[model samples]
Target chain A: MTPGHLRRDAALQTVLWIAVVVVANHLASAIPIRIDATGDQRFTLSQAAHDAVAHLERTLVVTAYFTADLDAPYHEHEAALRDTLDALAVAGAGRIDVQFVDPSTAERAEAAQRAGITPVTYTVRAWDRQEARSVFMGVHVGYGDRQMAVPALLSIPKMEVELVRAIRILTVDPEDRRKVALLQGHGEPNPADYPAQHPLYQLRARLGERYEVVQTVGDAPFDEDIAAVLTLAPTSPMPAATLWHLDQFLMGGGALGFFVASAQPDYQRGTTFEVRHGIGGFLGSYGLALGREVVLDRVHNEKITLPAPGGRSVQVDSPLALTTTHVERTAHAVRSLRSATFPFAAPVVVADPLPEGIQAEVWIRSGPESTARPGPIPLDPRLLVEPAASEVAGPHVLAAVATGTFPSFFQGQPPPGVRADEPLAKGRLGRLLVVGSGDAAANNVDFVLNSVEWLLEDPSLATIRARATGDGPMTPPPAETAWRWKIAVVAPQLLLGLALAWRVRRRRLA
Target chain B: MRNVRAILRRELIGSFGQPIALVALAVFLGAVALFTLWFDDVFVGGVASMRRPFAWMSVCLAVFAPAVTMRAVADERRTGTLHVLATMPVTSFQIIVAKWLAAVILVAIALGLTLTWPLALAWFGDLDPGPVLAGYLGLFLAGSAMAAVGVAASSSTESQVSAFLLAVVATGLPWLVGYALPLVPRPWLGVVNYLTFEYHFANLAVGVLDSRSIVFFASVTALGLRFATHALEQRRLA
Candidate 1:
């Protein structure tokens, strides 16, 4: 060929190669494989997600009502939500249909609201002025006649777990879904009596998404259908017969979660008083004790906004509310908890020389710079005195789980009302999770949800939540220590460059 | 392969013979440290991650890679050494590949200097080696792609400053397009966004070694080397 023809041939080859590359990129994007190099595999979908869609008997239709033109931060969440739904759709094997609708218009917005998807209002600054913009970002899923809505897309990392949870709710068989009993009639916060902002209401509402939350009177025998029992902040003692019934329930291999405090604090009065839920003796049988001491921490604490002497508010880091990142990484219930805070928390200690066949594990603890003292504790955040060097002994156990074949607390004891021909001496295998602070369950929804799932022997959903919780908050080093580290990181490179330059100049001079 | 290695060796030695390369290395290190430590607030954020440092290093390479490659071919052509290189048995492909390879090595050296950041993080807390390795992998890919583009720009221009400017624009437009996605029309949004460097860099930054991102970078590197080779052949024809 001539030189011009050869050049034309070369140019055609280049074009063809570029076309091949473009097509390859398109094909690669179409493939569903993404290697999640994170140690925790945060980006990869959990097995639970795959399983949730793998056996879809009916079409799971998901309608996402999200404004296309949202603020920058919402953009990431929208993309992640779409990606997760797309993955689920692919896993559903033609049983899932996904659609995205912009609910910007009023008619569409009204339709979305009817479907329980609400618009979130955000204020934006543009052209030297601030203006409010209302946007809809919510998901509605339907399987058969059952429907569940993820009210808002607030967290990007949490998007997958929330979507999977909604799908699980829609797909789970009605008979197979477990019932969670909230034992009441002893001054525990009831979901029915509290307002929307109450922690009990929030806890019940969050659990209601996954389980059938039922309020059972504590004075009677629990329904046999109850898979787990949760008792939160019982301010009064249970009846003798009721305690006996609880013991019998445990003897029947039921899972129990106790979130109670030995003392109750009245923040308005700036004082605390000891209160007994009458379960201390009951817990003592299982090798766990409800300590009366209130644990306070100096490190890893949250700031609470309090009314100042003036009309303004002051944010003070209160030791009474302890925030702990020291969670047990191995436990399924607590592994995904980045940090949990316990307000007016007490100690839950395992009995010395734990009972035979009973294995207990501490799931949560206070920071190293913490102290636990017996009540009545002062409720005033400002008036609490600092602990002395001798008093600063902690890393106190705030929560624990014990599992074994528990010996019946009612062993050799007769029935409270009726004479029994035979008294049960031993119980079957059971699990008991105890928390020092009732407020923790009311406050940290994830902790209670995961604990319930652990009790029910269903940890598939917890793994999904763990994938969302990528990493815990870092405890930054002291200022001087960080400065030292910075110098250590920066100095060697500078010095090496200078030394190499000097050596080169010296060789030239030689 | 032998011709490529000989050309690569010559280019590397010629690069280190000058004092400017050392100064450039120092500047890259100082800027990366400043941006990562002070601006990114890695200490304040308190996450045990080298993500911030790697991110700032990627930003630094946008300018640093071009500075390293601006003189790769431009200085030779300006000195009338292109004719000298043409007389050698080495093909234009070998010369361009060798030049690009040398620039990538310098980029790697600059990235290697920041290893102390990860070492410090690991010393302080539980640093997962997976994300750290993924981060370095991503930085190397992005930095090498930028270096390749710089070599192509240098082959087209006779002045170092002109070459640097050309390379910066060529490499930067792709990243800047990501920020302007809001302006892109709905019909062409995906196509335009796919051309952006940020779109691909972000996937790798999150510890996701995605196949699409790898393919995209490889394609960019190949296109850059091809353009540089074509420019060399044009000089031969002239």
Candidate 2:
């Protein structure tokens, strides 16, 4: 039959016409479909959108505040932002309305100001000129008390995750006090003092999604409802009262996470090798010390500086080494990052003398090619030597959790001058998570959120990796026999199997 | 229309009914599983940096696609079936569309078996499903372009072996193009990379489906099929 004769057939024409209509309809649905390798896309925003259309309540207005500098080449950023806003609309499904307002122009700024929204200032340096990028993500979700608010979303990739978190916040009653305590005193990194851009600050705020985060320090009686205590990298010597409060909390069955710097190499003050937290009497009794020197490992090095620009680098010991438990949650091990340079650091160590029942599980560790400078520490790194000379070994633990019962530094009965409100018998039992480095918890420290989540005991708030990670600019398989796996054996085996199949297919056909 | 239907039905049935093709489909499914889920344990922890899970899966699929589609036309010529096919009352467009549809069906079937990966991930975590959907869209779009390249390569050679090799080389051009791009002239190289299947797919993989990526894939596939048609015309002249 001719092509025209085939088209004249009703059934064939129907199928063809239907195919066009179906493909066009699906294409025109304007439903941006994303099917990932792992079937995570089963939960379509289209469903949520439909739901919103059915049970629509308050209208969600999203105002995007951005730089108005049209001449600048940051339009790439603006384009991405526009795409993200479009995604929010889809997710909102007729409930979320979005508007973009560029603040570079005087009129736009004046309008935004009148709306009680400030254009957050951020300076991003171009090759020549340094222009500003506005930090206004979603300044307002609602207007009145019933209004849902999204403080800001900095990047597009993380917006969906942020949107999910916002949904939980908006949905969940804000007054619910899911307890969280910020541990103070021991030379820990204070999130409140951290810069606004710091992860810890952002993390703490994110935790407020399901938690009532309260700062606890000094002689205040640690509350019972406190689910976890965040012992951020503590720098100053911890006071006895402070140690007592921590021990008591743990004894009361509360959880604690410490993002401590190990005997890190960096020197904040003086020429001391030790990272001193006043908890020596308290934590020392349990057999963990924030070691006075950095822990170095050889296993997980990406690259270290080769003394060149971009430097001939290898990933030996990174100060920002991520000691994640990827394998299995409980018994997960860490990499030996030997060349991940800390510049200088003081790491925590388990003391030689230890009481039984106390366990120290290393969260993250340093690589094999590490050394230690014990006392009268030098600021310059040239002084570091081989292990035989400097006294250190492979796989030094960077972060760890120490837990067991304890004799409070007070061995004898209660002190004579006891206040009426104070309880008798200073002795107590509880678990203590002591980290070595104080800087690890700081904003300037490792922004790897898993560490904080591990520390905070809030797995939901675990830090998502930076957006630039997928580029994998430096990572490569180890050429060394030690790091090289049985791929040599496997590759050949695969080749042999394919060859066998091909030979069999040829023989059968022949 | 009758010719296209005949070709499409024959191609789809012929491709799907073969035990070797079924086994290949299963193997591809196995690969999607390994790449999406088990690849982490394959490389020693921290060695691969396992940067983005979806990116690797797509790259691996890009390498694997031609192996499935390389025989659509090449083997027919090798077996002298093209002479019989050419004498039949069908145009090259019908043959092309039929073979292309067959390849798409084969890939779609393979993709169906791999849905278990996402199902398992959803059962495990509270991940946003859009990116995963976007990822599948990117994969299908990428795989379609690869299928077209396979057709082009297969038509150019009488030997299936040579066709397979050519298809591999052609399919791999996008990777080298994407990798070596930024090192060359910035804006020009950027455009070249943007035209590559991966450039848009990666954007889509993250759940932001820009129209440019869809258009790029469609155009590239058309170009590849057009090249195959030209190669067939050249063969006719010979």
Candidate 3:
């Protein structure tokens, strides 16, 4: 063959090979098959996500409003979001439709705003100038007549949780969702105070996704629509009538969750005030009672930043801040948690020789290396040193659950303004979940949501939400150990150089 | 297969017998350690993962890989040995594959030496071995692709310095294009992002061994090797 013809044929082959590679890569991207090797399998779709979309009765459409001209992290996040939506579409087996709309133009931006998708402004550095660019990273899902918007998807790690939750909300029948009441007459922190970081705000938001979260304030009866009642850390004593009404609510088979605190610590005053939230006595009438002491665990605990000298703060592992993995294995609510944190918790004890037909179990407890100090204990970190062997050898109950016919606190004795025959003495079958710490309901919101799901007997999605944990913070090594590790990691580079030099010298000698 | 293996053995010995290979390996390992520890503050971040090290090593291999492959074909061509080898039974494609494999082995060694970080993490904290192993796999694939680009650049040039610079610019473009994503036209954003090295490496770094990303790196390696073979063929035809 002529040299010219040979070169032309070679060029054609090169072009064809390049085209083959491009087409193969493009096809592979569309296939959406991935092997998730992370310990948590974070990249792979969770069972909950698959379940959320698998049995979709009607077509579900997920519309993602993202700006086109995004920079590094945001661009990467958008790509990840697309991949997740593609995975969901594949999981749905043609029931799920995904759409991407670039909301860069003013008209589309306004339309996106109307759809509850908001834009986050980012500062971009252009040629010799810095400009603020507003970009949209919100998602809207539509199923049947209902539509829900994930206002802003700022976190890539939490993208699956957000999308799955929105899908679940949009697809689930409105009539199927139960109602949960949060009692709020006695100075309990408001769950609606989302901006103020009220601990129960997280719980309220999560519950709002699956159930109707309503406030039951000032002698309001627990309506039949209410499947559960949660009284979160009420500081003041609940009215006699309110306590009696709760007893009646429980008698009617409504689940009750009392996240109670025995002592309220005032960080500003450096003192603790004893709280007599009447719910404690009410719970005591059942099989479980909250102890009037603050529990401290030195071994299984979390770190708190305390103000130190020289205008700085140092993080110290505070015993008052408890973290435990000693949760009930059988209960679906707490089983998925690697560890649960209950900061500044009290103790709960099951009353021995319990009432007839009542079955109670302590589902969560502090570590064996723990001490419970009776309130009003001082609020000093220095006073939290390791207790003596006699004082520190108990697994204090941090949370307990009881399910049975609960005998009413106002069984025979009616409260003021109540007729003698008004209250039912023994209630129907009910469930009661009591956590010894109010802070836990907020800090461990997943556990709270899971508990509610377990109470309602729908714990399917609990595991998926729990798996949203990106990665746990590493247990900080001691200063000496950290220094040793840093040296161990960096020193090998020098050793590699030394070995190379020796090899070079040996070769030269040979 | 035997011809490829024989060429691979010769390439490995030829590269390692010189002092530059050892220096390059040491520099690559040291650069990763310094960037991840001091720059990324892996200790302060306190997450038991090899994410930061793999991220920094992607940039390091742009320089390290070219340095390893610069003399593979360019120095032989300059010394007229490539023509002598062309007269032998082995095809230019086998030579290219062998050189690429040798560069990949060097990259593997460099990545393997940095396992101490994960080891210390596992000893002190909770280190997930799956992500670390996936990250090593990702680095190896990305470095192999870059090395193929280096071979292609070397095959086209008689000057080793020119070949190194050419490979550096070619491999460095994909890594640098990630930063310029915002400026890329909206019509071409996805294609431009897909062409980037970090875009494919990002999932693998997080332990998602994505089939698409694997295909991307494989395609890049094939394209590089094919380009090198074509360059050699063109020289012989002339």
Candidate 4:
């Protein structure tokens, strides 16, 4: 071939190769293939997600309310959520429709709010300035008339699990839902009265999505259909008949969740008064000692901004508001939860020799630098400072669960002024969750929801919901072990280098 | 095909025959081990993943890969061996492929040696081989692309230092482009991200072998080799 023709041909081949590569890459991007190598199979869709998506009888529409141009980590989170939704769509076999809505406009923001999606405020670095931007990172799932919204998609570890659980709950027939009774007659906020600012409003709404929230008024025998009962901060003491009703409910294999407080703190009055709801002795019979003292965790606690005499607000780290990471170590209900905050919490301890057949597990505890103050305690903000050396008391359990047949406190003798006609001696196999503070659920709704779910014998997606995402805090190895690893990594490489040098020298000599 | 194989064998032997090749290999391994162990504290972190080591690889290759390929064509030209090779029956494409392949093979060997990391981790605790294999694959593909750029740079310049600098700039520009992503307008952001090497490599590092990423690296390798072959042909024609 002529030199001119050869040069032209070579240039044409190069251009052709470049074009082919670009086209091939574009096509490849259009089709994605993922292989999850994680031991947890984090990238791969869980069986629950697949099963939930496959069982969809009607078209499920998922609308993600994500604002554009989010900052680091959040931007990654938005992308990860989109990718997860796409994977779910693929897994759904055309039953799932996914849409990404930028809630930038007021109308769109309002629409997101109406759909139960809340926007989170983010401080983002934009163009050499730190700008406060309200970004929406919630997902709304709708199937038929049923709909559920995930208010936040902050963590990716359990994104799929949360999405699947929401989908499952939304699609399930309303009539088939289980019954959960809320014991009332005390000063506990009514679940039916859902004021947005109410602490239990979110919890009530979340539970209502999966179960029928029934109010068990004043010692009424739990309806046979009730699966569980929740008693939140009962201010008034229960009558013997009411206690008997609760025991009989346990005898019928019902789950009981007690968010009882030993003392009720009046922040305005600057004092806490002792509270006895008459269930403390009943819980003791189940092998859990409810301490009459409030726990103060200096190490793992929250800071409260209190108004000073000079009208200045000072942020003081209060031991009374414990922010603890010491959750149940096992893969239990609290497994998925990273941490839970309990305000004015008392201490709970399992009996030295737990009641026969009853297995008690400490589900929540304070940090090592924690102490308990005997009530009636002062709610003075001045006393909320760091604890002194004398106040240190290792760690204290704030919540516990006991499972098995519980011997009733009234097994041998009934309470004073009560006529009992042959009360049941031993209760049926059941689960009882005891939290020392009613305000435990005030900070994290998932803490209470997970406990209730576990009590209901359905801990599906609980662990996944609590999974930590993105190179989660690495457990630092001991310094000595780290040194050993360094040595182990270096010694062999050095030996290999020396061997290579020796081989090269031997070749040179030859 | 026979000419390509012959050229490939010669390139490989010629590159490995020098003591500098082993030294470079040792330096690469030692740098990776030191950075991962001391700086990132992979051992102290107790994470049975090679993520920390793999994360440092792209930056490491941007510097070392050029050193490996700097002499591929520049030294040959400086030593007056390029004309002799040009007179041979082999095409410039074959020559460029051979030189690029030699550098890539060296990088692959270095990466292969780093397998001891995961193996050691497995001995100590549970190690997921999936992401490890994926991470190694990502590094290999990324290194191959860098090798291609280095070969092209070497073919363009007769001075090894100039070639090394050219190669570093060419390969390292994409990493800088990755940081410029937030500055790009919303509509063009995805396009700009797709053009960068780190975008594709990061995807692979996460164990999601998106076909686009594979095709991206493959395209980069092809583009770099194409440029090198064109450079060789121009030199011969001149």
Tell me the TM-score of each prediction against the true structure.
Answer: 0.84, 0.59, 0.73, 0.74
Could you give candidate 3's per-residue lDDT for residues A308-359 as a string of tens digits?
6686878878887878766665465775556778877888889898888889
Highest DockQ: which candidate?
1
Tell how far residue B140 is off in model 4, in angstroms. Answer: 3.0
Pitting candidate 1 against candidate 2, the one with the higher DockQ is: 1
Could you give the interface RMSD of candidate 1 in angstroms? 3.7
Error of 4 at A58 (Å): 5.5
Q: To one decimal, what is the Cα RMSD in angstroms of model 2 from the true structure?
A: 9.4
Give the winner by lDDT: 1 or 2. 1
Compared with the true structure, model 4 gives a TM-score of: 0.74
The TM-score obtained by model 2 is: 0.59
**What's the DockQ for every one of the candidates?**
0.43, 0.13, 0.40, 0.34
Q: Provide the TM-score, chain A, model 3.
A: 0.74
Residue-wise lDDT of candidate 1 within A1-510, one digit each (tens)? Answer: 666775776678678878888888888878835788888778877788999899999899999998885654455667788888887888899999999989988899998998899788876543344667788889999999998888788898888888989999889887778999988899788876889998767878888877998888756667889988998888898877667767777777888999988777764655677777788778878888887788888666777655556567677788878888767766767767767889778888889898787889999888766788777666556666667343447888999998888766666484567336434435778889899888788778888889999888899888878667665335455555678778888988988898879877886788
> Ten consecutive residues with minimal summed lDDT in candidate 2 chain A?
A331-340
Residue pairs in clash, model 1: none
If you assessed candidate 4 against the hidden native complex, which CAPRI class would it receive? acceptable
**Per-residue error (Å), model 3, residue A80:** 6.2
